[model samples]
Target: KVMGILPFSAPSCGLITKTDAERLCNALVYGGAYPPRCKKEMNGGSLELQFTDRSFKVYHECFGKCKGLFVPELYTSPNAACIQCMDCRLMYPTHKFVVHGHKAQENRTCHWGFDSANWRAYILLGQDYTEKEEKARLELFLDEIKEKFD
Candidate 1:
């Protein structure tokens, strides 16, 4: 059963660039300078997620690239460079989440994102479980989440 649907967006406009997405994916798949760290915990470990604040880096980069661009109209038209920068910051994973108390207390990385073509968000689980097991685990986790919110 679907518990609830909550809408969320990135906190800032310049944070989701392709370069940062590549960097984050590399950090997750391989190893990088900034690795994943637990950003928040909720409901006594029922849910926890890894989030790194790269806002400073994103702001610096965006400003550096867009500072000098000329805007034809103030307020009415935005600078082209600024628009491009914002466009580059689209459709990246906001964070990585883990749902605890699953049988062996396994640590799983779930990637959540929206597919515009399908008009739905999907949770792609890690490869540790088979397809059937993945579905069961996800349902169990969703139930736990629903219980907490309800």
Candidate 2:
């Protein structure tokens, strides 16, 4: 039998149709990055998929490089506010999340601008919603953020 291994980064392979890719992306993102929890059929795969928790590195806005500084190595606190670059700890308040394919600017400046095109649709877990519902969800998220830090 012909078999191949896929990387965790590219969960949606070129061989997958758009619809199927959407389904897969939804499962990967909303299921807390676990595919098996979202889809039962995925459990039958011989391939072993392992992933780290939400931890990710930060490419310092100051230096602009990876520099082998991983998030897990830098911070002891659970809050993102506590996470900092290894070299410039407690210096820069805002740092890019340093994840591939997504640019999440960690801003504390209170500017509420969001690029609609940049929305990570895969994180929605295949839920179909109207524009009104989408707006409500966005507002709810914003409200929660305000409540958390206010």
Q: Judged by TM-score, which candidate is best?
A: 2
lDDT of 1 by residue, 27-67 (tens): 34522111123223324533221222311111111101211
> Which pairs of residues have clashing backbones in candidate 1?
16-89
Q: Residues 1-150, candidate 2, lDDT per residue (tens digit)?
A: 011112244435357433333333432442212122234345554322222353233232211222212233223332333223333222111222221122222222221332222222211211233478755764464344324322
Q: Residue 48 error for model 1, in Å?
A: 15
The lDDT of each candidate is 0.24, 0.29
Regions of model 2 farther than 4 Å from truth = 1-42, 46-98, 102-130, 145-150
Clash numbers, per candidate: 1, 0
TM-score of each predicted structure versus truth = 0.18, 0.20
Please, what's the RMSD in Å of model 2?
A: 17.4
Q: Which 10 consecutive positions of candidate 2 have the poorest summed lDDT?
A: 117-126
Clashing pairs in 2: none
Best prediction by lDDT: 2
